[model samples]
Target chain A: MTAVMETAGLGKQYGKRWALHDCSLAIPEGKVVGLVGPNGAGKTTLLQLAAGLLTPTAGTIEVLGGHPGSGPEQLGRVGFVAQDTPAYSRMSVSQHLRMGALLNSHWDDELAFRRIEALDIDPRQRAGSLSGGQRAQLALTLAIAKRPEVLLLDEPVASLDPLARREFLQVLMEVVAEHGVSVVLSSHLVADLERVCDYLVVLVASHIQVADDVAELLATHHRISGPRRDSRSLPADQHVIEESHTDRQTTLLIRTEQPILDPAWTTRPVTLEDIVLAYMGQARDQERARKSGLGVLR
Target chain B: MMRFAWLQFRNQAAVVFGGLAVVAVILAITGPHLVHLYDTTVATCAAHGNCSTATSVFLKNDHTLQILFDALVVVVPGIIGVFWGAPLVARELESGTFRLVWTQSVTRTRWIVLKLGVVGLASIVAAGLLGLMVTWWSSPMDRANASMYTAFDQRDLVPLGYAAFAFVLGVLCGVLIRRTLPAMGTTLVAFVATRLLVNHFVLPKLIAPTQRSFALNGVTVQGFGQMNGGPFTLFPANPNIPNAWFYSTQFVDRAGHPLSTQVLTSACPLLESGPGPSAPAGGGVESAVPAPGAGSALHDCIAKLAATYHEVVAFQPASRYWSFQWCELAIYLGVAVVLAGTCIWWVRRRLS
Candidate 1:
């Protein structure tokens, strides 16, 4: 399958700090790709790089086999909903739709009106008066009505209440199912992505910890608990992502292709959140080690 | 893209144009009466030999309106820059709506170009209409004052160019600053600074001034004086050219060298007097009239001075008013175009 978005060693820096660094990923077409990370983990930076809101400081990025925001055709093919879902505050809902129609070559007027009507948002109401959920939905309608091949959303539901978040996800899933457009949305909450995302990319500390099909990741990663032991003794094939030990018990989140043959350990299936958190913890430890190692060198 | 630009610009345009319309109606109502007053008084005052009184009366007819209109022409372009141009791009960036519009089926270059073109054109048109209306309504007063250069900045063609330059400068500031209020403030300061710089420094050198020499006769010599026992000096009256921009008037010898005090004292012993009656304490001319009984001595001294030295005056003639206006317009428009190109480049390459 063709990759909807691809980056090779992509990096972005602001002044002395690197927002995203040494990132490489090829997101397959037609998948709900969840870019999950902790706060300040460069999730927004990577998404913005793909959406052409920002340029990479190192390496290169391509969306749908074209440079992001390179030309009219490239711009038309990709849709971007920024973090705040900003719309012209003074402009009414209908004016926002008019703007979409006027600015996009392939604007789906019927779809735009249908979404607004179904959402029960008043066409004459200004965007600034709308609730947070309504604003996000309006922003989504604008993005999707342009009929883009790929949609990139940066923390669209980060500010919404749980119910609003659920409704947003439901609408998003319906749009994805109906249009089959590739989606890449960033969120700090893994639960937000759990219901809709089929592809997962775990980013931590300005780097990609893991990226893979959700089912494959679940199949390969297992949480095993047993009597206290050193993680260094684990077989090389079973990579320990995260490890915890008490006086008499040890638990490890491991990624391995083979089943655990040791009967001493109790192995249980892991949720998506478990997999993400394990990767996050592993990345954090590595970062801490690198920092303290530099301190020693200094 | 044009439609979208207009859609965004229409409200600001409405407010500005509506204000202009109200001003236009007021001018239309009072304009003909002012013109009629000028025709009856100042125009025919020459035959009655009461031109001074008639001209003053005509100028004083709409004193408050004159100040208001003149101030309007000067301030409108800066207003356009601050309210229209600065916020045009900065608001989008500040509100994060650029992400929505820029990602549509339009290149950033096209987006900026269209926005600038649409709004810039409207600003220019507004300034032009304002210039035309004010120039028409204020014609009587301008003629009565007979000092065209005094009101140069608040008059025709130049304001249009100023509006263009101010608009583009604001856009450049907005693009670089990326915030609305700060950009507006910066644009205002920048626009005012540029106008002051151009007005004070750039304008005088635009065209070489015309030089004319007048013999140092009694009529040409406004006054003469010696200050605190210093060398004697002569003051030449302004050249008799109406509505001219005078650069300077110098007392020069036949060889084009400045006439020295040593030569003056030697040629006329009467100059040894403390100061001429017309000379103020600091050597300025208080009156053209010579002291009582010293008139003949003054004439003799002037005659002696005229034989060797003459008064050289440099000024821009009234006939060159249109030329200066056009030159200023071209300069402002040229700079505006360069600034606009810079804005486009910055938006495309540097903004992200």
Candidate 2:
């Protein structure tokens, strides 16, 4: 599939801190991609950079084959629902629809109203008075009604309750099924993305620790339990992701393309959550180790 | 984009235009009565006598309206600056709605331009219309008071100029400050500061004031001195220019130079003042004296001062009223453009 967004050596600096540093990725088209990261791991920063809400301090980024925020064409091609899914609180639902129609060249008014009606949103009611779920839905309706080629949502469901989150995902899934548009939604919750996303990028400590198709990642990574043995003794082909040991035995989550043949080890398939957590844990450890090492050297 | 911008701006425009319409009707009904009163009172009294009392009576007829309109015209620009311009971008940024609007099928430049263009033009027209109405209503009074050069900013075209400058300065303040309440505060401070600075330090110098030198023979001297010892002992030659904005009134020599206080003091010093006590025991009349030849010397110095010292006054002449209006308007419009352009640039470049 053609890439909908591409970034190379992308770095964003906020004062003395690097929010996102030396990041690189190519999000494939026609997929719901999950940009999973912990709080302050630069998920919002990455999304903002792709959405053209930010200028990269270093390197370059392109969304839909043009510089993000280059012009109306690029803007029309990409849709972004920023953190909190912002909508003008004073505006009525109908006014928001009118605004959407007037501002976007590719606006689908029928789709917009139909969705608003389906969601049972009162056209006369102000957005500020709407519930959190309703406001998120209205914001999503606005973004999707633009019929963009790519959608970037920054933690759209982070503030929603379970039922609201599920409903939101259901509506999102329906839109994707209908339009086949590319999507990248960021969240700290792996469970939120697991049900909808086909591709995943795990970010931790300003680093992209992993990026792969969900099924491919699951197929490659495994948890192997065997006799007590140092993690370093594992074969080079078995790349250990996370390891834990007790006095009697050793357990490890590892990634390898080939099937395991060692009778001494019992391997189990890993969940997406486990894979994400393992990567985040590994990145955190590496960062801590590097910091302590530098401290010792100094 | 323009349509969307209008949607966002329509409420403010409605409030402004609607409020103005109501005030306009009131002014319209009462305006003729005021002009007639001015004609019967101040105008007729100008040739007859006691025009000052006539003017006071004329002004008394609609004191409340005049006060309201005066306050409204000045406060209108401040209202625009605080409520409209200051909140234009600050509200969006504060609420994170810029991300939503900016991500739509509109470039950030186009977004900012449309917002500013529609709302800014609306702001100017609202203020301009209010100014026009006030100017028309107050023309008879302004004529009577000879107030064109005195309170120029409170009437006629300059308020519109002030409005334009204030509106743009407000938007710039909003962009720089980023938070709505803080932006509003900053806009008020910046707008007021700009107005005061220009009014006090700039407007007078825009067109060089004309200066005239006249003999001090008829100088009006009033003070506590028996001779020339008190503050006001040396007065400027009276300037004859009517309705002029006087910058300075000073005493200058025949070379057209200012005569120093030292020269006046050295020429004639103070006499010992007044009679002694009037009680029977201590009331033997006063004993005061002058040094030898002091009387002749003071008279000679006074005669020399009358002959040589000349008063020079620099003033913006009354005839330059329209010239000042246009010049100040151009300056304010120029500043408005520059500030608005910077607002656009800041929106596009630094808004993130």
Candidate 3:
């Protein structure tokens, strides 16, 4: 299958600081990809780069086999919902729908009106007065009704309440089920991604830590705990991701294709959150090591 | 795209055009009455030999409306720059809605072009209509006033170009600044400054002024006074040039050299040399009353001065009014086109 997005050495800078730097990824088609990172980890920057809302300072990015936002054709294939779900405050909901239809050649007017009607949002109400969930829904309606091949959302549910976030995810899942559009959505909350993401990309400190199919990531990564020991003693095939030791016990998160043959450790399946946090912690440690001019500990 | 542009612009258009409609109505009703008054009074005042009185009375007929229309014409372009142009792109950037609109099937180039084109054209049209109405309505008063260059900035064709330039300038500021309020402020200041600079510095220099010499015949001599016992000075009245932009008037000899105080003191020795009783103290020049029997002597002195010297007046004649209007319009429109090109280029390449 063709990749929905491909990047090589992608970097973006603002003044002296890099918002996203030296990043690379090949997100495949048709999966709900989760871009998980901490706040200010350049998730929004990466999404904007893909949506063609920003220009990379260092390298190239392509969406759907073409330069992102290169022309009307390329722009028509991808939908973007920026963070905060901005809408014209004074414009009515119906007017926003009209704008979407007017600007998009392949707009699905029926689907848009259907979604708006099913959501119980008043078509005449100004966008500024809508609740956060409704606004997100409206923005989602606009993006989806464009009939794009891919959708890029930057933290769409980051500001919504728990119930609103759930509802938003539900609507998104329905749209994905109905249209089968490839989606890449960023979020800081692991639980939110855990529910909807089939593929995972963990980002931290302006860099990508790991990106892979969720099932493959889960199958390769394992949490093992045993008697206290140095991490250097682990088998060569097992790549240690994170390690913590107490006085009498050692806990390690490892990624390897091989099974544990010695049976001296208790192995358990890790949740998506566990894998995300382990990667995030490992990246943070590497950054700290680089900053302090010290070698990686163990 | 055009429809979308119109949709976005219609509300603001309605507000401005609605106000214009009201103005048009008032001008339509009062315009004919004004023309009638001018025809009955000022137009025939030449035969009655009371033209000054007739013109003043006709000009006073709708003094408030005259001021209102002139002020409106002057201010509307700036208002369009601030309220219409500044917010065109800046508001979208400020509110993060550019992401929504630009990502649609439209290229950013097309989007910005349509937005600027639609609104910019509307600004020009609105200003043109305002200029046309005001020019037509004030024709009577303008004819009576007999000076086309007095309120030059607020008159025909120039306001249209000003509106175009101001609107584009505001768009450029908005694109570069990426914020609404600051762009609006900058547009207003820049628009006003450009208009003033062009009016005071650039417009007059566009064409070299015409210089004419007027023989000093039967004209009043303003005063004769010695300054700090240095030289006796003559202050001659300015030459009359109707409906012309007078730049300067100076007393010059036949060779165009300026007359010296020594020549004036020697040639008109009948005039007092020191600060006479009629002259104000501190060596200032006041209208010196002639000594009771010195009228013939004064006339002879003026004739002698006229034989050697004449008044040179620098001015722009009334016939050049339309040419100046066209020149100014072309200049502003040209700058506006350059600014518009810069805006498009910036929006395409630099903005993000």
Winning model by lDDT: 1
Query: After best superposition, candidate 1 residue A253: deviation in angstroms?
Result: 0.9
lDDT of 2 by residue, A48-141 (tens): 9888889999989988788998888888888888889888999999999998899898999999999999999999999999999999999899
Model 1: clashing residue pairs?
A: none
Off by over 4 Å in 2: B44-64, B214-240, B257-306
Give the per-residue lDDT digits (tens) of candidate 1, residues A1-298.
8899999999999998999999999999999999999999999999888888788999999999999988888988998988989999999999999999998989999999999999999999999999999999999999999999999999999999999999999999999999989999999999999989999999999999999999999999999999999999998899999999999999999999998999998999999999999999999999999999999999
**B1-352, model 1: which lDDT tens digit per residue?**
9998999889999999999999999999999999999898999998999899888877888899989999999999999999988998899999989888888889999999999999999999999899889999998888888889998988888999999999999998899999999999999999999999998899999899999998888667866764455566776788678899999988998889998878877887775563344453343334334577556666778887787899999999999999999999999999999999999999888877
lDDT of 3 by residue, B229-346 (tens): 5555655565666779888877889788887877876887766543241333333444455555455555666789988888788899999999999999999999999999999999
Clashes of each: 0, 0, 0
Q: In candidate 1, which residue ranges exceed 4 Å CA deviation?
A: B225-232, B265-276, B280-291
Q: Per-residue lDDT of A148-229 in model 3, one digit per residue for the tens?
A: 9999999999989999999999999999999999999999999999989999999899999999999999999999999999
Q: Could you tell me which 10 consecutive residues in candidate 2 chain A have the lowest summed lDDT?
A: A1-10
Cα lDDT of model 2 by residue, B41-97, tens digit: 888895887877887777677778877888899889888988889999989888999
